[model samples]
Target: MELLFLGTGAGMPTKERNVTSIALTMYEERGSFWMFDCGEGTQHQVLKSPLRLSKLEKLFVTHLHGDHIFGLPGLLSSRSNQGGTASLTLYGPPGIKEYIRTSMQLSQSRMNYELNIIEIQEGIVFEDEQVSVSARMLDHRIDSYGYRIEEKPKLGTLLTEKLNGLGIRPGPLFGMLKRGMDVTLEDGTRIIAADVVGPPVPGRTIVILGDTRPSEGSAALAKRADVLVHEATFAQELSDLAKEYYHSTTKEAAQTAVEAEVKALILTHISGRYAQDGAQLLEEEARSLFPNAYVAHDFWSYEIPVKSREEI
Candidate 1:
């Protein structure tokens, strides 16, 4: 899986960055991509990237802030116009349904595909055989949430030597065994999948948080994540301003990464006041507290590698 930052700026758009929109592209894993937030001009950003509206299967909105969701209507409308006939699932906090519904109604927009909106609560928001997502309320000005996405453990490799010894060659039976299913030979010999398979490969975990001040909720949701994406709207020197605005500073974002013991920390939602040099300062400040901290810019992408069993 990979995270593509479409707009990393906080509140408003700037020459360097747009607002807060992220795309989690899983083309190899699921043949689809999931979006996080959809700030103004987000479709324009997508036009610049390799992502396609037809592959947008899911969208998880953090909050109802203008900077976080203003481009939803336009993006949704464009998806239908661009031949996206597949159903789209959206998960977000309460009032999201009303906002999208009203926007579509006011604009007289009609979508050819089904739009499923789920107003989320503080718990498991989505789950399937491949992945599970849980949400927790963060300390934002509004009811913001942080999501923990955990990919399910993958099946281990099938021991070919062991199977070969049992008079089994690579075929449909091997596929079944690789999937952790027991298979019986034509001669009635039973083969146990676990005995001939390696240990399960550990999955990866990612935590993505919305705009918020430093809080336990952020740390809790980010526990031991492969990567933690947190908002750092200001530098350490602007701690007072960050608190007043209910946003996080570089130091606070780094502290959460440390507290959660995440492998890497990516700071986003940067304020426009921070120019190129100023933004570098924020990264330096975060690295002081957490060496793996990185300040994400617009269109920057991060790859989250799947962990091996030994890594776990």
Candidate 2:
């Protein structure tokens, strides 16, 4: 799995950054892509990348703010035009259904593919065989939510050496052992899967916070997260302004990462007030509190490498 940031600015689009959108690339896990916060002109941003709206299986909207969801109608309509024939599911707050339904009705846009709109609540927003998603309320002007995505664990690797020692060659027998089945050879010797496989590899956890102030909810949402995407709309010098706006400061965002013990933190939703040099200064401030804090920019992507149990 990997995270591809389509837009990473706050409130409005800047020449240096767009609004707020991130694509969770699940090409390997789900054979599709999932997105969070389709900010304004998000479709335009996707057009510049390899990700396709047709392959966009799931969308998780953090809030109903314009910068977070103004691009829904455009993206959904363009998906059909892009020759996408697959069904799509969108998860968001209560107003998401009304917004999409009304917008589509007003625009007289009909889709060729199935469109499933889910009014998101605090519990399990999405769950399938491969991945599960949950959300929590955040401190914002409206009913904002923070999302937590957890991928399911994969089965352990088959030990070819162990199998070869038992006179079993790699073939359909390896497949059977990997599927947790016992196999009996022509010589009446039985081989159990446990004896020929290594330990199961753990999956990845990704946490994304919408606009919000400091809260335990952010910490809980980030527990053991491999990558945490948090909003840092203001630098430490603007702590009072950040609190007034119900947004987190650089220090507050970093502390949440430290408290949650996340492996890394990507600070997004930056204020345009921070120019190129300010980006470096803001990154430095966040990292001083938490070494893993990283300032996010538009179109930045990172992959989660698969590692063995010992490597982790």
Candidate 3:
């Protein structure tokens, strides 16, 4: 999975950054993309990336702020215009449905595909064979939420040598065995999948938070995360201002990551006042607390590296 930052600036668009939108592309895993937030001009930003609106399957909005969701209507309308017919589901806090519905109605926008809007609560919101998503309320100006996306543990790799030793050549039976199914051979010998298979491969966890102050819920949601995407809207010196605005500072975000024991921390939703140099300073400040902390810029993409069993 890869994270594509379409817009990373906080509150408003700047020359260096747009707003807050991120695309979690899972083309290899699911052949689809999931978007988080859709700030203004997000469609224009997508045009500059390799992501396709047609391949977008899910959207998770953090809050109803203008900078976080103003581009929903335009992006939805453009998706239909571009002949996107796949079903899309949106998950967000309460009032998200009303906002999307009202915007589409006011603009006379008609979607060609099914659009599902879910008003989420603080718990598990979505689960499938591959992934499970949970939401937790965050300390923001509004009812913002942080999302914990946990990939399901994958089946252990097939022990080809073990199977070969048992006179079972590669075939459809091997596929079933890899899925943890027992098989009976022609010689009347029963093969137990668990006995031959390796340990289950641990899944990766990612926590993406909305605009918020550092809170216990944030750390809980980010516990053992492979990547913790937190908002850092202010530097260390302006931490008081950050708390006053219900946003996090670089130090606060780093501390959250450290407390959560996340492997990496990516700071987004940067304030527009921070230019390239200022953004670098924010990264440096965060790195002082957490060595793996980074400040994300618009259009920057990050690949979450998988961990081996030993590392986990």
Q: Which candidate gets the maximum lDDT versus the true structure?
A: 1
Residue 97, candidate 1: C-alpha displacement in angstroms: 0.5
Off by over 4 Å in 1: none
Q: Where is model 3 more than 4 Å wrong at Cα?
A: none
Candidate 3, residues 1-312, lDDT tens digits: the string is: 999999999999999999999999999889999999999999999999998999999999999999999999999999988778999999999999999999999888899999999999999999999999999999998999999999988788888898888888988998888888998988889999997788888888889999999887898899989999999999989988998999999999999999889999999999988997999899999999999988999889999877676764
Worst 10 residues of 1 by lDDT: 303-312
Tell me the lDDT of model 3 at 271. 91
Model 1 scores what on Cα lDDT? Answer: 0.94
Per-residue lDDT of 208 in model 1: 93
Please say which candidate is ahead in lDDT: 2 or 3: 3
Q: In candidate 1, how many Å is residue 197 off?
A: 1.3
Q: lDDT of all predictions, in order shown?
A: 0.94, 0.91, 0.93
Query: Model 2 misses residue 18 by how many Å?
Result: 0.7
What would the per-residue lDDT of candidate 2 be over residues 226-271, giving only the tens digit for each residue?
A: 8899999999999999999999999999999988998899999999
Worst 10 residues of 2 by lDDT: 303-312
| lDDT against true structure, model 2 | 0.91
